[model samples]
Target: RRTVRAIAVACMLTSATTAVGLASLVVSKTVMLRHFGLTSGLGVMVSYVVIITFVPAVLTWVTPPKREEVRRERTSMFTKVSNGLVARLLRWRWAVLVATDLFTVGAGYVASGITVDHALLDQFDETDPVYTTTLLIEEKLAGVRPLEVVLVSTEEDHFMDPEMVQTIQKIRNWAALRPEIIRTSSYGDMLRESYVLLSGDPSVRSENFKSAKQVKGLVTMMSQRDPSPLNDWLTQDGKKARVQFKLRDVGAQATMRFLDALEQEIESELGDDETVSVSFTGEAYTASRGQAAVVNDLLGSLLVAVVVIFLLLAFFFRSVRLGLLSIPPNLIPLVATMAYMVWREIPLNVSTVIIFSISLGLAVNGTIHVLARFREEMHTGIGREAALVRAARGTGRAIVISCVTLMAGFSVLLLSSFVPVRNFGELIAITIGGCLVATLLVLPPLLSVAGGDGGVRDSSD
Candidate 1:
């Protein structure tokens, strides 16, 4: 029964953890979704996960319990590593390598905090014609973000008030100073521009044209090009008004900064007590702000998963030190990956934001397997250093196999047409690779010093 439980736990940790990372990759292929929409792209993702996760899991579950027999059948004297240069290093040289990895992981943590934004095709490519033309539109036309900010007030007369018109005009003036902002379009801007074009006509210059016929004629002229989705921005009762601004490009950090500033100004100007408040939607700039919220949610999900992992580890071992040792290795890979992005100038987009959340689970798998084996060896009365070697030799094959499978699965995303999704996959694969190398090489040595049998307590306990 104990043997079966161990096998089941091992299989679940390896398979399910890898599945989470692959799912992040699957959901993030933006080009597929962008080109085909949700129905087709989402269907492909669901099918892909099912095949990858279930097929291997079912095969592992049904396989006969003759791992020892298979091991004996496969081994020859050459497989023993009795006396080569490689064997000599395995015995004495791993300490230096482990120290270097630890240093890299530590330095990486410090570097990830300095955030940078991506350029228009930084998520795509300037070499691609579609992306190039898109860049041209952003650079030449100065309109990229497609966000609209609507100001709504409860009193019908409030929207037509001269004060309200002046407020929107001020906001537009404030927005125009930022480089990432293309332009701000409001009825007030239209009024002023049109009034100038109409040879300074007093009738056209009236801030609140209460006459329905005059307002209708003005609306018709503005609707000629309708650059800002003006119809949708209007309130149902005609008591609300909207201002629209397009970003210089999607995923621009400058645009996000500008929107946040504009939102704050609107809130401060109107105050919460008044019925006047600004609401936002309908542009890539809005979606970029949404990405910040998504990052917050992903962090929350990670915290929940960490709680679950601690409970599961405590339940399995009834020990604290082993569980505590497991935590650092799981976390470092994510920090390292983010650091790589910072160094390489990758922006935090929707797809890239979720990588660490998913990678956390995958990084834990090899640590679990390694720790499990080390504890088992200690129970059999092996010395700490000898036990480390036995643990590595025993579980190394399984850990390497799982890592390879995960790397291959994530590598499939390199074929994606979306540059951001493709970069995300490749970076995640690199992180998983680092984790695998950390577990098989660095961790075994660390545990020799750290995982003292029955001496270290679980941090949670």
Candidate 2:
């Protein structure tokens, strides 16, 4: 019965794992859900469900269970069962493995923090023809980070008045103080700062329009057209003036800070008055703030997942200690991923935030399986030592297999055309790998020290 039960459990788990893997492939292929509208959280949740539900159900009916072995004795059976596996795992040198992983995760944190963000354009290598062409085009053309600030007046005709024109010029001068502000241009700046030079005397400035006499001759000689063309940028009613500025190679965090400061400066210059006001509209600014909002959402979802997992563990084990203990190992991969991001110079964009949250649930899944098996063994009246061995022996292969299934599921994402999704997949792959290591190496040692050979219910206390 014991042998049959183990086989049944393993088969059930494998099938479920396979289904989830396949579901990930199908769901990931869908365009609107994967890329445009849904948040990464919603997408990952859907993908995870698709995998978990179908695979196990199909496999359970199809595959036969492993042959059952009758137990000759229950006392030393657990030890004998896990002996070979434990020895094999220990052969890898746990101390060295732990030390290396700790150092690597730590170093990644430091490196990621120190590295500057390379612009999106720079991400493609020079060897790529597209990158080369883009670089050449960028040099000859204007910048890519599009931003604009429109200053509007209560009355349209007021925008064309000299008072409004000077106000716009002063705002441009104030904005020039920020290094991130590359350049500012407006109709007002041209009229206020630029002027006609006398035909005979280059050194002299015209004191009056009449002194220049021939406005037509002056316009014709300068190879310039009437400033009236600038009206296209102004509001139809002539109540608003716009000053445009572009940023170079700025990440979401930097963009947010810049906007915050710019808002304050705009408010200081153009207060809550009835005559004038400033409003900003652009993809760059909106996306930056949106990315930050997504980060907060990811954090919230992870917190909820943690709580749910904790409650489930506590209720299932009837032990708060075990429940609390499970939470930290789950967090290991998250912290490590963050440290990796900090190291790799990857931005916490929309894609990565979703992967990071979903990864928490995934990393904990294997641990839950192992713990569940361990509890089952103990409940069956096996001794703590025997139960611990039974738990390890029974669940090790399933845990390893589950990790394989997850890796296979996430691999499809590597083929994504979207850069953000690709980055997300890579980070998730790392988290999955890290979790596997934690379960196989860290969990075993931790279980040993924590006395998984179940004594009293609360080990920590």
Candidate 3:
């Protein structure tokens, strides 16, 4: 009962802060992130209720450990180190703060340079069978990804017109020059090839046909493949034409550049008229678009988490300055990890960008635990230095032990064959390590700077 009472306020504070951080995800534009935020936030609150209610009732049936055993634990190496750490930190508060500020500013600068991108094969390692087989398929198949440019016109039988046929050839020629596009095929290009073959005149072309009826004759005379008919590229009534291009194995940034350039070339061919509306659609194109949304949604989530957590901390401590102090310990871990990711060339992708939310929630939980203990100790009329030392020893062992256990749990992700998952695990482990050090070394000295005079002075002085 004493133990539970001692931790009850801190426990509630941790749960409230964690749940609020997760609740910010409700504003995410992506459905997956929204659901993740909702369910996970609810889960955190539910667990908090269970811990406070169920554990206390069960404790009545359990036996307490001997006082001697508890005393021995307090004298252990972790406890001794935690006390020694604060003793040294209280001696050089401003120096520690300056060093931490310098590191965070440098890290933030480097992290700002990270480019948002998407790559289909980036999930797998190069030596993996999935990756190797995909490369072989791209080699033999003239590229496996499809990007379709659908052209629509209000005019009936528009695609069969000679002017439209010439326009398509210009677009095809543009596509052929792009290294990202391995092959370009469409109804007009195929008909043009067939016209040159059948007419026995080297001057014959799709534009030479000059009429819809003449173009239809060439389409009818062409030998249809066993599966897809040539009409697939040309819709009935001839109002729309599907120009399919097989895209090369390229990253999202390269694909986006190609798409942007293609849009310009298309405008140059068709001119500023709604007569023919062009749109890009297909597997590769849709994935590229979705990657952009992921970057936007995750960055929004990160902002929301920060704001909600700051408010929650201020409310818990009942002081704005205490709330403001929480920012450095929590924010710096994310900054340092992101800087490490930039150095390692890890792009913000599906699995990796989530590191901020997970690590920040955890960082807040640990930091608040120590801060809560410091407040409790000060309430007993001890000086700031003495209170800090007591809080460090009181909460340090559990915080370090919990963080080490989490690091081990996350390390399991490193065993995954998927590269993104492995990187996520690796970066998360680094962040947790950062959080542990910050909670012990950085946060305590910074708290001493907060103006609060307890009734007693430090005995060591």
Candidate 4:
């Protein structure tokens, strides 16, 4: 009952912050992400209720450990580390604070360099069979990634015109020269092959035909009753034609570069022509487009989480400084996660960017627990230093135990076959470890120097 009473509010507040982070996913442009946010957010709150209510009910029947045993557990650690350790550290609190500021500056700089992109096969490592087979298929046969190029003309049989055919040839010829494109196919190639086969004259050339009439003559010679593969590339009336560009499965950087270059090429090739406009659609292209959306949506989600949490902290403690102080414990962990991404070569893609909000939501729990305990201790009229020391020593063990449990839980995901899942696990563990250190060591000196002597009494009175 004593334990539950002491920690219940902090646990509930932690759940609220975590739920806010998870629930902010509704703003995501992706449906899967939205659903995930709703369910996970709801789950966190439900778990909080269960922990506070159900655990207390069960504890009522269980006998507590004797007071002496508890005292021994607490005082034993004090003897070695010494209770004056916190006060001793505060004598040079200025140095500790300065070092923390320097670390933050470096973390911010490293975080700024993260790049974003997305890919399907990226979920698996290069050594995985799926990844290796994909590469082999692309190298041996052709690019498994298909980019569809469709040309629409308002006029009937527009693609049959020799001029349109020449335009198609220009695109194919351009693609052929690009190393990224494994192969290109279109109705123009088909018509040229048919024109030669039917003419039975090697001298007759496809590019030589200068008018729609000449191309139409070749098409007319083929029996309507016979099915031709060219029909699939062209509509019944030939208003639209399809050109397939099979491209190699280049990595994210190269793939995005190629897409940008293609966009420019299409604009330059068909400039000022009202009759034709180009757009891209395919899994590979869609993934590239979604990268921008991921960055925008996830960044917005992170903002929502931070704003909501700051407001909550400010309201709960009734001290804006405390709320503001809560930020570094969370921010340092977030920056550490970004640095982890950079160090590990993990791109800030769809699977990994959400770590910022999730880890931030988590990192605040220890800070809140410590501060909340400090408030409880201050109410007894102890000096600020005595209260902070009491709070840190009192809550420190529970925080360590909780952080260890969470770290163990996150580390389990390392065994996942998906690279993103594994990276997520690894990053979350690193972040929580940072948060543990920040909350225990860094937050103490901060509270001592900047938190003021009267605590909330200074503001409240």
Candidate 5:
């Protein structure tokens, strides 16, 4: 009965702590993450209700009391092993502390190397149809992605002004010459083709328009022809012109860099042109900005989660030291998971980055359960060492069982076809396993040494 009550209390506390971290993701700008956060938070609440209410009710109704006692005694081997391990750990607590510090330092070093990956193409396997099709398009057609440069004129038909036309032509020429650019097209191309046709000389180019009147005449003549495509490139008022730069399918970071450099060049070439201004918009630009937003949200969510969990622990235990002790066990799993990513050269993307908050929330469960049992044992008038051993024996098996169940649940994600989803599942499983080890092995000794009287009996007593 005592063990069952302790388990119920611990499970409820674990659910609350985990929900705090998951709830923080509700503020993310990404729609997918927002949905994930809400669903996961609800799932935690539902699981807690079921574990506390349904499981206990079923045990009470179906299982006889005498059989329950016999079953518990049959599990005595696990308790004995746990008690022996905790006894050994408490005796060598200093060595354990040193080893933990060294491991944490190494993990922290590796974690520092983790980087955000902005590439959309890298999300899938090379043999994926999307990947192969994109490659084929880059090789055969005008690239798969378009980087648009919109040139705005201060007045109507200003696109016909010789200086404006020259600036547009220069920008197009610059883009066309770049190896990364597969092709370039604009109203400038149409103007050049019309000029050659009108002059009856293939050598004549559109830049040959020496005066504003000539440029206007060329635009007027083209307007007479079917202008559906022309309307897309030029605004109805002729006040805006767009140059479409078809770029080879470069990854997100490289694409952003290219756009930045091109914008700078446009500024330098069209210096102080009060009549014209330029801006950029395209699929590549949107994706780059989205990646940045995700990174910011990830960092913010992590900070909020840590603060919330810390406060919750403090409030639950009514002891600041116990609350502080909760941090290292939870953090070890998160940091070690990131270190594993660094060692494996995995880039932190939209899906993988959320693992930090999720792991933090889940990892603290074992720590809370162990601490709750330790406090219960101390309240029975036992010495600190005996309480620690008893707590480990009574609670350690439950923590291990819970962690294994959670890991198995998350591990099912490995079957997902998406690489990010698979990686998320694998990393989360590792994180739960790491948390189990930290909670069972590392946390008990720390509590024995630092947690004086196990927060039950005062020193004056």
Candidate 6:
């Protein structure tokens, strides 16, 4: 009864901590992160309710006190293996510590190289229909991604003014020089083409418009066509005009760089001439802004989760040392996960970066259970070494069971058609397994060496 009670309490507390950590991600600016956070946080709570409510009830209904005692006395294969492993780990504690430190440093180095990528292309397989269709469109016609440049005239009818039209033509000519811009459509293009056709003179192009009245007449004539394309580019009041640039399928970072250069060029061209002002908007710009938001939220949420969890652990155990001890084991898995991403060239997108905080929350579950059991044993007058071994035999098996269940649950994501979802599943599985090894092999030895008198005290006492 005491054993079951301890496991139940520890499980509830651990689940609560993990839920809190995941719930924090709901505050993220990215829609995907917000969804992931809410779903994962709810999952933690549901799992706790199911485990704490159902498992014990089922156990009590089936197994009588005598049968439970007999079951406890009969050591399972997992218990035997865990006990042996703990014994061996204690003997080689110093060597294990050295290896752990080396692994952490190496993993941290690799993790530092992980970059954020939020490109839509990165989320799909190259052979996917969407990808192939985009490529085909870029080849045959204009690129799918539009970069809309809005030119606002200072005066009401200034859109037709010769100077404003000239400035727009100059901007288009500048854009034409860039190979990244596959196609550009503007009122300037229409007017220049019309001039060439009507005047029967190729030389009398865009700048040849004599005045605002001539430009306005040309615009009215163009608008009378069966389907006027000018309506899309020019506002009803003629105060605002749009230049749509159809870009080749450049990746996210390249697109952002291109936008930056294009903005600088626009400023240089029109900064001195106050005829019009330019602003940028489009799919590419929105994506760039979303990527930046995700990165900022990732850093902020991760910091908050770590600090909150550490303080919670300290409060739960009534010992700051035990809380501190829990950190390395949890952090090692996070660093190792990021290192794996770096090696695999998987950029930390909206989906992958959240794994760090999620994994930290998960990795600490086993540590908390093991530490709780160890403290219980110490309270019963057992020495540190004996308590660690017993804790390994008892709570260690529970950790393995929980981890296997979690891995199984996460493995479902592998079947997802989305690349990010699949990567997230694989990385999470690796993180769970890594945290288990650290908890079972690394954490016990750490406690024995650093926790001289077994630095944990049960807060309940």
TM-scores for every candidate against the unseen true structure: 0.71, 0.68, 0.91, 0.92, 0.90, 0.89
lDDT of each: 0.64, 0.60, 0.82, 0.80, 0.81, 0.82
Tell me the spans in candidate 5 whose CA falls farther than 4 Å from its real position. 1-4, 64-77, 177-179, 206-208, 457-461
For model 2 the TM-score comes to 0.68
Q: Is candidate 2 or candidate 5 better by lDDT?
A: 5
By TM-score, the best candidate is 4
Name the better of 2 and 6 by lDDT.
6
Note each model's CA RMSD in angstroms.
7.2, 7.4, 3.9, 2.4, 2.8, 3.0
Give each model's clash number: 8, 9, 0, 0, 0, 0
Candidate 5 lDDT (Cα, 0 to 1): 0.81
Q: TM-score of the candidate numbered 5?
A: 0.90
Pairs that collide in candidate 5 are none
Q: Candidate 3, residue 429: CA error in Å?
A: 1.6
- TM-score order, best first, reads 4, 3, 5, 6, 1, 2
lDDT of 2: 0.60
Model 5, 324: alpha-carbon shift in Å? 1.4
Model 4 scores worst on lDDT over the 10 consecutive residues at 77-86
Residue 143, candidate 3: Cα error in Å is 3.0
- Model with the higher TM-score, candidate 3 or 6: 3
Give the per-residue lDDT of model 2 (tens digit) for 219-277: 23333556554554565456766778766546666777888888887777666566777
Clashing pairs in 2: 15-55, 15-56, 16-56, 19-55, 20-51, 112-342, 112-343, 156-238, 156-239
Q: So what's the TM-score on candidate 3?
A: 0.91
Model 2, runs deviating above 4 Å? 1-119, 126-137, 155-157, 173-183, 189-232, 264-274, 316-319, 408-421, 445-461
